[model samples]
Target: MARNSADRLLRQFLLKAIGPIRRLGIPIPAKISKHLQFRGVVDVSVGSGASFKMQSHGHAIENRMYWYGKRGHEPETFLPWLEASKTAEVVLDIGANTGLYSLGAAATNRTSRVLAFEPVPRVAELTRHNARLNPSSNIEVFELAVSDENGTAILHDPGGDQPASASLRGDFLDCKQTEIKVRCVRIDDFLSEVNLSRVDLIKLDVEGIEELALRGMRTTLQTHMPTLFIEVLDARPELMAELNGLLNMGYQVGDLCSDGVIPYDLSDKKGVERNLLFAKDLSRFQ
Candidate 1:
């Protein structure tokens, strides 16, 4: 049964109402959250004719559920993705936590092939479980981290229930509860190893290690020139270098907003902490 807007609103209100109580380790909010799911996962209907299967207990699942019920989440990001994938044959989603963009893309375009890469094994399995829920969607889930080089890295997982803040940054991971060694591969190397074709669109959100991931894909960026939708979190040293590297490599970077994609000025200290789009062709977005 579809949750009407009223039902969704009521659930959120209840969650908020018991938040303080729940924070005191009361477990009331958790019980309420558990009841919200019709099954083990909540179904969210994303635009372009697709629904996402989300873990009932995952991080930010509430807001994401609201968005799915409404048919889109982040319009600024989703709008461009929807547009780019119309003609895209291959799409890469890195750091695809529970496969939001990955599932969203696959749902939006049935003909497009979406590869979701998540280093966290547990999270990756969740992505797979969600993909299976959308049986008709052509989404592939991978459990390897992408970096500038091929090797293993210590991935910090903030627990399965709270995966939004997980990353490979040692400092960032240090604050988290668990650390696990994970195998990583560069986009270039992975493509060759798997014999995958050129990717037309890439959505990257690997925390502060965006530069390292980009470095590993220098060849792909130069040769394929895929459209990029990436998020830059905080003021990491790699952020500037990654932005500069994109500019040097003939890509125009912009910020996605409710209105749409706006020209990005990386030097602006205020805008460094937002989602960015890097593209060689801006016609689709325009």
Candidate 2:
């Protein structure tokens, strides 16, 4: 009874907060708004205050919705690599949010297979939904968080349309306070279990847990030497270590923007931290 009451209270608070944003009719990019509309996910209003109805995917698809609209577009930095790779047979999307990379890769013909991993249940659900909507025969969705160890952990619900880092405190504004036993697996174990010989590309954007995931994939790194496109945020020291670890492994790195690749070295760890890239071999691109 108490749990039900708490849930109701949380719902009310979230609705109250979301209602204002919904009414404001924020301006979203055309492509993003269109995608959302086609999927019947977003009900947006343009400059004229006219109500625009997005195509409904069906009875209000949940867990597969993309929050923040076009902001969810593939980070400009990774586009070139994504386009340049013609022989990429296997793609691994770590922290595959709402199937952006997952759906995009599945849409492309070059990518023969894709494995999307999202630990957050809500986001994972959306990933699965988008994958199904797109219907990629080769895409596989895994609803588990990847780390160095294999076990269950607490997934904090910072409730919104999308899932954020699982927090330790139960203080999300509109999020229901609940504990989900999410699976934690390493890349080596994952590869062994699935018997994957090679991975062409690995794109990771797992909040602040990238290091742990990388640590778990040391074996995969040594074996496949797949090109990695990681979203390296500058806020965490642990993340910095992960990037350094990759560099230590002798991978050449660069930034992927809409224009082209900008090669860089992370030898200096003291500048105003920016999103950078690393590659195992620059000659491959040349």
- The candidate maximizing lDDT is 1
TM-score of each: 0.80, 0.68
lDDT on C-alpha atoms for all candidate structures: 0.76, 0.61
Tens digits of lDDT, candidate 1, 159-225: 8554776778777655645888999999998999878868889998897788889889989888988
Q: Which stretches of candidate 2 lie over 4 Å from their true place?
A: 1-72, 164-179, 257-259, 267-275, 282-286
Q: Give the per-residue lDDT of model 2 (tens digit) for 1-286.
A: 9998886576557545654564464544444333232234553222132212222342222212233322234335434444534457888888876656655555443346889998777778877776665543367889888888888776666666665455322442345656777888888899888888888778877665667888999888877788887766554677667777777777887765544566765654542224455567655554
The 10-residue segment with the lowest total lDDT in model 2:
44-53
Best by TM-score: 1
Global Cα lDDT for candidate 2: 0.61
Total clashing pairs for each candidate: 0, 17
Model 1, position 237, has a per-residue lDDT of: 63
lDDT of 1: 0.76
